[model samples]
Target: MPPRPRRRPSDRTTRARLASVLALCLVAVGSTSTLPPASAHEGAADPAHAYYGILGANALDLTTLTGTGVTAVSLEVGWDRLEPQRGRVDPVYAAQVAGRAEQIRAAGLDVILDAGLQYPPSWVFDVGGDTRFVNQYGDVWQGQVGARVPDAVFNPRVRRAQNRYLHRLSAVLDDGPIAAIRVGGLWYNELHYPPATVGDHRNSLWAFSPTAQAQSPVPGYRPGQGTTEETAAFLTWYLEEINDYGMWQLRHYRRAFGWRPTLQLLLPGWGVRPGDVDKAVAGGLRGATRGELTGALNEGLDWAGLLPRAATVRGHNEAYTTWVDAADQGTDPVYESPVRHLVRLAEPLGLPVAGENTGTNSPEEMQRSVDRVHELGLTGLVWMNAAQLQDGRWATLDDYRRLLAP
Candidate 1:
């Protein structure tokens, strides 16, 4: 889970961490160069068969996993953590990834790469043309950890360098028994812009880059302060720009891994709005959309425009939605899961949508996630941090076993 920013006093109960995501099947599973040929035979297991996923594999003694039917493990490819320098991946991080991959494969589980570009190296900050993402407050988000979200949409060199990093990292993995790779930018391995509530700034919009400002539909337009028509126009561009970033990564992922593995596009907790639904209708996606689009314009998420492109990416793709918000936020009016709405959008296009819980710390929370997963008929539910299962206080191993049992 991405760290939550301090909230404004008036922003009580709002799902401020829009980057925490809703969930997704997160990259479909297909016959890849690394996998055994038997998994691909006709009438064998479906190519997209894995349901359960664990995000942090190294944190746990994965060899102990069994009987809970955990099918997939997420390989964290944090850019800074992987590539401390520019030319190649940090060998230590690559070795850790490889070791964890072997543990996951030994447990008869699949592997998925949750590629995160949040923590760019020092050189990435100087890649090209003011490459760091600037929020509405002129706060250029940068750090060695999860702080540096790049303006890749505006800087082509940043995209090239990032993809080159991905290609290099993939080579280090050396085509192991991997099922999928979840491609994302911004934060938390999910494709989203920076959150709105970064240290009590409620009016956070991430379109202040030099090129973003130059390409603005309504120059000098602040969100919600402009005319309704101007807001819509700016928002359309904002969301489409984010979608363009998503598409660019998808193209890179295809080129990086070729047609061997499937891909998943992650959408954060931007609840779908009636306007989005109206657009969905206009675009012939569905009769309606689901959930109100919370932090939609601020987060630069245009689900109506983004989902179709993701579902059609290179044939086999999954709509990865995050369901932790609805479970965590409970009845909070501001937070919602677009799972049902995503189902409306994804199913019509034959796309498989799945989810992941931000964290299932307690039995109650785990049960809530499980209940929603069953209710929505999601492809599967991924437990975000497997290490949490070892702690006996919140949720024990048995608790996760019970909560996640198929």
Candidate 2:
């Protein structure tokens, strides 16, 4: 996760060539070159889509991921991990990432990198003084407050720094070898919660900072105070900020390289209802729960709309079965409306839609989910938590490979 180490003079040129090739590939795919259309191949045919990769939780268990015949790996690389201190990167972590990337490539697998914002460096928090109730580590502190937490993605200063960080990170791997770049995550995590609970014990409120608050475009907004109308406006503005940040990154990759990498958005969980212990859940209509709403957000994105431009639009479908099966015990109509809407959404964009963080372990449930995916005409699927493979709960990597086999 650290910045790549200094290289020998000869290696520097080699790295540059590698970076150039990656940039060229992106450009060719995005530009009006006479190259074949991006979607000409199916997910099964694309080497990048062959094996469903796990997230950071599973990636930490390298032995399991590698042994399960996983053809690709995806993990959250925190900003702290890449640059632990102010402007200082650990060379060892960089080498490890590079080494692992090569290993995966050598084994004929793919690598999807996630540069995340959740775990930023400690210095970032001290800049405007931790005003949010929740700290960066997701903990709530009593009687400690300051200016509102800064929305790093929207703050010009923070945004510029983030862009630089990503550019450098990409430069390191662009030439070295990797499959795709995940430019976003569960971006809605911070925006949807009420401002009063911004740093509450349950919600991750402390994650916000004064810088984000001061730079907010919303008028007369304070760190922990806002009227209902102001709250709604702030939420809308924040969502736009997230969308803009993502689009900006996408555009940069397209303009600089000629092809935009894939974009992924994490769907919220089904833990929205009271008494739900899981953090993944969110509430929905008619007691439907968060899973349905999560799918709805994906539908709203019109994921298919990115086909002509983006290489892929992946949904981190975290709540697919968690809430569905939970509600199956009762006759809640088990509405398929969200899935139906998703199908309609994808039909026009002509881009491939995929589930990237499906955590279901039951074979029956997994198969049912797969059926839903097929019903909605999704192009690919990636199951999270590779350790589940050893437990014999979820389908093994071979199972997914077979599903995607030619």
Candidate 3:
């Protein structure tokens, strides 16, 4: 009898082997690509010589802020106030915003225009209902920071409307005081969905709109179906959606302003408990993260994708770090510190990293925060609100001013 022919591998087995090899090759390529080049920007920024910036119009008080040596200010430009009606912006409100930007510039301070999409007009709910995101529990996520917002970033209709608003804002402001635009009104002026607090009835996971579902890679996915695998997939998708929205705003800014003004993505700059993220995954990813989670594909900001889209990435974490230290929370210093991770994320992208004081840091914590910024050579430092500059806190602002002064 003829020798039996050798058994052939099944098509499925052959395909699996090929796929594994292909994945390994891709991983190798990706790993090599992310390595820092000669002369990374992370250590290039000198916090000692960095610009001292402040958030809000409190810095607009030129006499007081200038006296403290502030060089920049961040202004919150409200979307609802600017365009309360669809296809039309209130002339008075628009003028007020434009005037504010101009005044900040005339005062010889760099201005960062914070246009938060979270401040959508009321009509948005009615007109763009299809784009609104329904959470796993079949409830729409709304009333974020007291404003009703949809998962509008990825929605085509919403993006178009927002693009129009940005254009109008640019036309009115005329590129005078605008040094940068920090986009995002998600929650607390940072990125990510609403809180996934335990026992809360509201759903924190979003972008479950028909549009989002249609674009979703996961087929037949439903909310509240808590499974680790499914939750992980959703988290990955949601991060991409965030990246898309960020890139969208950057593009719109360029179109309107005829120049790519520095685009900043304000991040919490704190770390979320992995256990909390795990719980959120079980709760349909209720947009949970303690700080800027950037390592693996979990429920955190996708800094790998976002840092490239932004010219500047600012984190609000130093005060939290101070609180944790003061309270003896025993948090990991490296994990809690946004400077190390931000420098790592932004260095390859050549983006400047900035930090904001939470207005709660003690004098000692303030010094540590400034020291970290200086060590990392961060681009700038901004005090969160007016409180840091008022009363006896004037010395606090003055300290940062002198430290950051070139």
Top-scoring candidate (TM-score): 1
Instruction: Report the lDDT tens digits of candidate 1 across residue range 28-142.
Output: 2111223222112112113234477776665666666778767787766667777888886677777877777777777788887766676667788777687877776788865
Winner by lDDT: 1
Alpha carbon deviation, residue 238, candidate 1 (Å): 0.6
- What are the RMSDs of all candidates, in order? 9.7, 14.6, 15.5
TM-score of each: 0.78, 0.58, 0.72
lDDT order, best first, reads 1, 3, 2
Poorest 10 consecutive residues of model 3 by lDDT?
1-10
What shift in Å separates residue 103 of candidate 2 from its native position after superposition? Answer: 0.3
Clashing pairs in 3: 45-377, 136-223, 270-290, 270-291, 271-290, 271-291, 272-290, 272-291
lDDT for 400 in candidate 1 is: 62
Task: Tell me the tens digit of each residue's lDDT in model 2 across 1-406.
Answer: 4222111211224334433433443343332224232233223223333335554432444554445545566644556677777667667766666666666566566676666554455566554533233332344333211122234453455555566666656655655544555544223111122222233322232223454555556544532355545544553454455455545656654443334344443332221221211111222112122322222221123222222334342322111111111111111112222233333334445544555433445665455544544444454455654555445756665665454444
> Backbone clashes per model, in order?
15, 29, 8
Candidate 1 lDDT (Cα, 0 to 1):
0.62
lDDT of 3 at 212: 72
